[model samples]
Target: MARDPFATADLEIVGQVTTASNVTLVCGADGVRVVYKPVRGERPLWDFPDGTLAGREVASYLVSDALGWGLIPETILRDGPVGPGMVQRWIEQVRQPVGRPELVDLCPVGEIPEGFREVLRALDGGGRPVSLIHADDPRLRRMAVLDVLLNNADRKGGHALDGADGRVYGVDHGICLHTEPKLRTVLWGWAGEPVEDELLSDITLFVKALPGELGDRLAELITDTEIDALETRGRALLDNPVLPLPQGTRPIPWPAF
Candidate 1:
């Protein structure tokens, strides 16, 4: 079998992402920074199938690319040091702790700020009130739209980043593309707002190309039923073309960061 560009690259581990379920390594490959998530290192999750999160990560990049939104960084499924897995461009951004001082900027709740959206609220360890807030930047808004289409189940405040290129990028998509409607996120700021004409046009294109183009590629990574669900979600987004109202008992992820 022919190898992808990343398949045989020399990878040196730079660091480890401890919070991730899988052993995620920040690696330097041919002088380029990339994150490598090996399939063999993945710990099983109850909701998701075993050893398939890497595929889901790659699938997310494919969807973002197909949509022409560039919401996700460049990602490829290839061999790593341990085994075949997912490798994605490492986004460089100033790191901020999840809660505490940056919490208001990254995620806010109650008496929302002028330019932020209150996605959800929660109580801290001491039963203090906290709200999840996301910036109202248009780039983030587009990411929100992408999350909806992906049926993203984990869109924490920390997953969205302000990249060095001045673009908003979303990470940690291993739980996406589910057959069910699982659109949890910290991006409810645009709920009830009309989707911009430009974004709507992109969504239209994605809907048209999904089944024949993107669908074939995603089938290799996820289930056929997931592909079907993806199309269903895309069509639903097109039909409404608006930020949706939150549904179900839990519309936001825990520790929203």
Candidate 2:
């Protein structure tokens, strides 16, 4: 993919972001928080592949939209030292610890509070539901579930940020949405459990709503095979069963607070 080049002046670097190489949280001209990746004369992973990352970012963004609000970021723009880096919505940090911090500390669920059962129960399953488990606010669950499916290897406690604005956010896509099950996550204990009905219904609706133009737009970044896989996964999520969770299990990541 051809990278869209931009000058450094294009973004407003805000704070420091470690874990990944050459990353700096920056606000773009559009006033969106984006992690700036600098591509220079170096290896693909080390320097930056420019458009490749941007394109992948776009694909993830598209899938998030399909899943509902759970997967959200502002948009991917071609603004970086060498080319277009990923741009995303900044979720405000959750100020209070809503659940038990100990359980999360023992395990790891992307910064999710332990004993969040009550909070999960209170959510609404998006009315435009699917067959399997889903959440009332499809958007929030979308992000959490996709983070699991994508196997965002970096979805550690801190990465699973609490956007104080009534939402959650996931970041660091350096390792996500792979071909394999690669499901190394904090939410694994919940596997084989019953998915929420309302959430499943939402997934079905979300898939049917996929736009045609998006196919073409995504073609520029990922392969036809990747797109097809995502579709298949969406179906699988919809068809998933709703088994009651086993003892000592968690469907999503526990906050590693």
What is the C-alpha lDDT profile of model 1 across 1-257, one tens digit per residue? 85544546688888999987678999888777899999888788788773399999999999999888898999988877777888999898855555433322432335666667666677666777777676778988888889988899999878987887777889999999888788898788789998898988887888788778678888889998888888888788878888888989988887676
Off-target runs (Cα >4 Å) in candidate 1 are: 1-8, 95-112
Which of the numbered candidates is closest to the native, going by highest lDDT? Answer: 1
Most accurate candidate by TM-score: 1
lDDT by residue (9-56, candidate 2, tens digit) is 366666656544445455554444555554331125532323465556
lDDT of each: 0.81, 0.50
TM-score, each model?
0.88, 0.65
Instruction: Give candidate 2 misplaced runs (Cα > 4 Å).
Output: 1-9, 28-33, 38-51, 97-104, 107-142, 148-153, 209-211, 242-257
